[model samples]
Target: MVDHKQYTYRVIWSEDDGEFVALCAEFPSLSFLAPEQSAALEGLVDLVRDVVADMAANGETVPAPLTGKRYSGKFQVRVPPEQHRSLAIKAAEQGISLNRLVSSMLSV
Candidate 1:
């Protein structure tokens, strides 16, 4: 079983639930809500551990933790033709490649 701690976990206040909610990115469907942030996170960790064990016991594929994965620093994004043209023109005006311009925009 994958280590539950290896998964990407986040605890945030949920306006709808009026409680702190813990979420595991890899297991989108799973969440734990509690009045306290620590409790929410701990509960979600236990939930992830159990789910991972069950998946292993059932011989089902389990998702790899985001922390354990390698990133290539490259991804593809598609934009509308007009938006693409605008971005390209902006990049040219700035004397930079589209990729660099997009990277700068995203960084901001």
Candidate 2:
């Protein structure tokens, strides 16, 4: 049997759009969009599997989890109330905590 622990996907809901988004927490880069949370999650899983398979075929190593020491910093910004609400809703629908969503975007 193939090793199953190599890949995994997670589902999150977006409150603003009222739809679910899939995120591959294990492989942060793998994500998918769908009308429903379940569909998005399923799609992400398949996508990650395909990516892993392709990497294996090409004799490439699957990336390992992040481990290097991370730096800490802080900043402040102003956003309209409506925009903040929309962002919160979107974060909720993606099933990710708002902090994570914001952090991910900021990192990018």
Tell me, by TM-score, which candidate is best: 1
lDDT of 2 at 10: 68
lDDT of 2 by residue, 36-102 (tens): 8778977877787788778878888866533432556666668899988988998999999877788
Q: lDDT of each prediction vs. the true structure?
A: 0.96, 0.73
**Native-vs-model 2 lDDT?**
0.73
Tens digits of lDDT, candidate 1, 1-108: 678789999999999999999999999999999999999999999999999999999999999999988899999999999999999999999999999999999999
Model 1 ranges off by over 4 Å = none
TM-score of 1: 0.95
Highest lDDT among the candidates is held by which one?
1
lDDT of 2 at 15: 79
Q: Where does model 2 exceed 4 Å of error?
A: 1-6, 15-18, 64-108
Clashing residue pairs in candidate 1 (N, C-alpha, C atoms within 3 angstroms): none
- The Cα error of candidate 1 at residue 50, in Å, is 0.6
